[model samples]
Target: MTAHPDRTAEGVWDLTVATPIGRIKAVVEFRRRDGALTGVASGAGEDVPLRDIAVDGTLVTWKQSVTKPLRLNLAFAVDVRGDTLEGTSRAGRLPASKVTGTRRTTPARTAE
Candidate 1:
């Protein structure tokens, strides 16, 4: 697993989720401050806040509240290859589903 130098100590991650609801894509922005992770989920008219984001190596876990007063417990074990992130996402108490996502690549910067 490779880490991106451009990846913020905390930042947003765009993910694609495969569900019975079809393929839903969202941007989950995370901030690591004082060993706590916090962020928001943006997709399907849902901008839900994420709580208790935790990262152990390449594995990430968090909780997101749905609009219907329900919450999803998500777990992702990501392997970074270049600009792509391959992983699995499991929602709530269901079994994990295969997921693959790419990070939006930005142009390399030149030293000023």
Candidate 2:
């Protein structure tokens, strides 16, 4: 069953995040289980689970740490409009960078 557009952020999202090095691409998957929201991001040969995921209206926020290409802790705040998302990611005390993402029409599959 499809989730409500305004209430749920459960889906796979393709994200383009800007960093000091360059623009990196990642896929994030959000899920709602047992009344809690959880997510994971896959990129740069790393798949890390999102922390402190909170959703309010269309606004979603989460924290993640990555250790490939660079090691940094990231905090994300995005506004979800339908299938698209726009926001910023901040690394420690550095300036925030633009972050844009779109919900994937087809969920990614693993090789079996």
Candidate 3:
């Protein structure tokens, strides 16, 4: 069975994440392949696949490692609400950074 679009984090999202150096803007795309939740985050001229993606109801969490401006192992936990998501990301002992994202919407195609 297919999950409802609003209830699932299976779409493209624009994310703004706060970091010690500065705020990093990224785009994350979530997908379900072979009944498994998977995702990828692209930012800072790098595209990295997310690991350990877990979803429960409207809560989604994943781990990602980014190497571009710098290298850091990140863990993300977020709550999806309709078209928006709010969450936090932590890197080791560093303070958690606020993560906010909006689902990207595509215009509906009309038959000619």
lDDT of 1 by residue, 1-100 (tens): 4453323324556688777667777776665556566677777677888766656555555666665323565656555554456777767678777666
TM-score of model 2 (CA atoms): 0.90
Model 1: clashing residue pairs? none
TM-scores, all candidates, are 0.64, 0.90, 0.87
Please give the ranking of all candidate structures by lDDT, highest first, separated by commas. Answer: 2, 3, 1
Backbone Cα, N, C clashes tallied per candidate: 0, 0, 0
How big is the positional error of residue 95 in model 3, measured in Å on the Cα after superposition?
Answer: 0.4
lDDT of 2 by residue, 1-112 (tens): 5446435678899999987778989999998778677889999999999999988778899999999888999999999987899999999999998999999888687679
Candidate 3 residue pairs in backbone clash: none
Q: Which has the greatest lDDT? A: 2
In model 1, the Cα lDDT at residue 88 comes to 77
Worst ten in a row by lDDT for model 3: 1-10
**Could you tell me which residue pairs clash in candidate 2?**
none
- For each candidate in the order shown, give its overall lDDT on alpha carbons: 0.62, 0.89, 0.87
lDDT of each residue in 3-111, candidate 3, tens digit only = 5643489888999998788899999988778877788998888889999988887889999998878789999999998779999999889999999999989622247
